[model samples]
Target: MSDDGQDLAEAQRAHWQSAYGDHPGMYGRQPSAPAVHAAAVFRAAGVRDVLELGAGHGRDTLYFAREGFTVQATDFSATGLKQLRAGARQQGVAGRVTTVVHDVRAPLPLPDASVDAVFAHMLLCMALSTEEIHAAVGEVRRVLRSGGIFVYTVRHTGDAHYGAGIPHGDDIFEHGGFAVHFFGRAMVDALADGWRLDEVQPFEEGDLPRRLWRVTQTLPRERA
Candidate 1:
């Protein structure tokens, strides 16, 4: 990462921490549309455990737990994870949900092929550079079992916010204190190189109605 990238990362982390601290459940207590879709996908694939990246406040994590899948949720903001834990207890699903303060730039704190499925909603589109995004996806791949499913969503280049902010280069733009790396179709295809690219459905979210793609990909099963 360039010096600018490193500085942006630190600033984003601090911004998230403060945001969660001030707003608590800033995103409200509902699972995202992608999470709802992913839960069905995981269930159909017979997934028993799920690892959720960038699971802010864990609305989706708890939903996965309530749906009977054990969940491990991670986010860079400890404050957000704190809220998630409290919500889990309140929902009486604490036994099935675990929270970790993790940055996607680092390796996942799990053994290889340890998780049945992985879900990351709008995480890949953070302030991450293109290389870092690939690395983060690599970490996701490393943690997933063979034939595991990976469902993630990202704001795309067509989003209204894509080119409307302080340009940090590498498709990253900072707006309203949030830095986003809007993804392009080619980058998405490149990331799915070794995996089976299952589906990429366009969707919209929030009042900004952030334009995104809900991508579903799977690994090949291990040979006998």
Candidate 2:
């Protein structure tokens, strides 16, 4: 990576570290609405092993573990993962969950065709550049098994804070010490190349009513 790229990566990582350090369980205890909906989708698809990106504080990771799915939960924040691990132990599902500190901007450490499902909540809209997002999606496509599912959520252009703060990139804005790359319908469509897009629906959550797009995609048995 270039110096500029490295600098951006460091800044993003430092921001998350500070954010998680300040509030260990920042997103709260309950799983987000997208996660709740995703659980049912996984159940219907008979998913077994799940790889969750940005498993912040393990709220949703715990839900999947409790549902009898073996999960590999990953996040960049060690402090947040510590809280997640404690929660997993308390839920009596420590054996079913594994935690790893991973930065999504880099290539994922997981193996190809190893997981039946990949779940990411509010991860795609981070400070990643367009190239990085494409790289991350390529990683997801590689790690997914035949017909494996990928589900992710991100803040969309329709959000109240879409352009509320300092402009960073296309739709990216810096607010509250964090840089967020908000998505639009066109951006979502561009990311759906290798996989069969199941859905891309808009929804809102949180006390501030954060606008988001819940995307579901499935890998086909054969690739081109």
Candidate 3:
């Protein structure tokens, strides 16, 4: 939204703002493969309520809606969320999708133990600091109902672009006017600290051969 925050997230926010401005619908009108795969997983798990972070352009948001999932989709970029809402309305799934302007670096604007599942794509691998990442994961755990699922993808350290640009921070590199924080096994492990790790698999995307880790986990049905 407003480019007024004094933090690393501000820089990231500005970068995406410019990108979305210059190239609205940059990724086009298609849900990612991970979204399709996640939908299948949700089906088997009987997940109905979902919260999606960084739902850029409503691609995955609309996908989940089409698959009969009720979703609360959030993104920091007004342009992106605006595009998302438009897409949702165009697909006649506006009633199933709720859009919110939110930055995941801060606390989630949701009640505790509310959502049945949380989905995010490439949101965790942005230029977030470790503390921000930890905070985001903590908030996810807090907002998830017992036995809630969390599914996300992050740029992996094995990616082709991992060490190609200016070193900004821990596991982060600035390349092509964008900053990315790449993940290792340990990083993903830490994020699954409070949840049971269900699956972790490697995948690649785009022509850059961007290596990624698709993660799935669940909070125990009965918390101690």
Candidate 4:
């Protein structure tokens, strides 16, 4: 990504920071369903080390750490990280959790093939464009070890309530006083070329239907 793109991402992060910085439990105290599901997958697969992108409030991070996984929880907001650190300390799992400030649209700071599992919840849906989503996916690919698992949830483009007749090519959605992007399966699969698709479960939250993709793949022979 260019410097201009980084600036836009930073701006978006700042917007979110301002919106939820004071409410530490804005995302929730417990992990999202996708994160809980991902934890089960990781435990079943015998994976121990986990990296979570956009780990708002460290809900999943705290859960995974308490379950004996070494977790690196990262977000772009300093306020979010401060809340996450406080949460970890309160849970007495601060040693098990490592927090970092990372913008997913940029290259990840971790060493190549370092993480055993990756989790992203409601992240892909926030990118304003397909190009940005692909860049974030590239960063996800960069930080995972071979045969690592990736479990994430995205707002499906097919939901009527959330879809709101938005054009197929349009990535942005304005609803419920929030503007975010929704992704279709095609767009997600396009960026997930090397990864083997394990599951694409369609479900609903309240009235909003969503899709969760669970995948496990080896790092391609080439580096990002």
Best by lDDT: 1
By lDDT, the candidates rank as 1, 3, 2, 4
State, as a TM-score between 0 and 1, how close model 1 is to the true structure: 0.99
Across 97-159, the per-residue lDDT of candidate 2 in tens digits comes to 999999998789988889999999989898888788889999999999899999999998888
lDDT of 2: 0.88
Top of the candidates by TM-score: 1
Model 3 lDDT tens row, 87-113: 989999998999999989778999999
**Candidate 2 ranges beyond 4 A from true positions:** 1-5
Taken over the whole model, the C-alpha lDDT of each candidate is 0.94, 0.88, 0.89, 0.74
Give candidate 2's root-mean-square deviation (CA, Å): 1.7
The residue pairs in collision within model 2 are none
Of candidate 2, the 10-residue stretch with the lowest lDDT total is 1-10
Backbone clash numbers for all candidates listed: 0, 0, 0, 0
Mark the 10 consecutive residues where model 3 has the least summed lDDT: 1-10
Which portions of model 1 miss their true places by more than 4 Å? none
TM-score of each model, in listed order: 0.99, 0.95, 0.95, 0.85
RMSD of each: 0.6, 1.7, 2.6, 3.6
